[model samples]
Target: MSWKQQPAVVSAPPSEDAVRIRTRSGIAAVLFLPALFIAKVLLLATDKGGRCFVDDIACAPFPDTAFGALLVAVVLALVAAMAAPVRVARGALRAQLLLEAAGVLVVLAYP
Candidate 1:
């Protein structure tokens, strides 16, 4: 078929509900990073002699590279989360959550 003969595809714009959901999700994602950072910093700061929780289960010490990676991840996640409305934000939030969770798990796994 010719270009004009081909079926035309029209995409609907984002709805109000979608927008609200995205804004909320983005806000949550943005908040999550800083909160995690603050908590981790506090936990580490309180630990005497640079030692963390027993066997470092709760808060394991992290190397500079790992910490830098985490920081970059958080910034990227926050940006992604804030980039669009609800549906897009939800996806970004999920990714951010997974990344953060994986990082935490890795830290916990260390002796």
Candidate 2:
């Protein structure tokens, strides 16, 4: 090639292996949302209900039935999320995130 018309350094698209790795990573990241939700629910259920502690301070009590219901909902959402395809999974993930965020916001803002 002439100096004025040097050959272009074209790059090949990602190989199948690279594409597969990327897809796996994407799915893993997406799945993490549901996993996180489930973990939080389980942690909350197992841990004692409390806001803070002091020399003789006590935290507000919450109902077991309410907590149990919350756990059930979280588990259901997790199952749906796992079963969904990548395209549908995104919607489920967004919904779970939104619900969690909204719940937190309401608690903090109201309480």
Candidate 3:
């Protein structure tokens, strides 16, 4: 709807506060999802000859590694959610939950 004209359908009016809040939300969603996605990728991605452990490095197979990564991410997310702004925490944890679900699927499909 035009800022000056009320819409036929009921919708939020484009007030300055509303616009600013919406913009912040839009930017958060844009940055948050990909950042979390990349976090998961960093957590899950592994090298094959990571097939065998190097001196101190423990390299397991895919499912084991993925499961361990999921566990770590879940714990981290829960801890972070405790300290975050309510709305931001909810969104972050929800996205983490989804990424964990996908990680589970990938782990299951590994064999």
lDDT of each: 0.63, 0.49, 0.54
Best by TM-score: 1
lDDT tens readout by residue for model 3, 1-111: 657876698866455544444454445435644664665454445553323333334544466676677767765665544445556666656655665566545543442
* True lDDT of residue 47, candidate 3: 56
- lDDT score, candidate 2: 0.49
For model 1, give the 10-residue run with minimal summed lDDT. Answer: 47-56
TM values, all candidates: 0.46, 0.36, 0.37
Compared with the true structure, model 1 gives a TM-score of: 0.46
Best by lDDT: 1
Q: Please identify model 3 stretches exceeding 4 Å from their true place.
A: 1-61
How many clashing residue pairs, candidate 2?
Answer: 0
lDDT of 1 by residue, 1-111 (tens): 656566788889877766765676566665765666665565456544146444544553466587568758866776776676666667776777777676655444442
- The CA lDDT at 37 in model 2 is 64
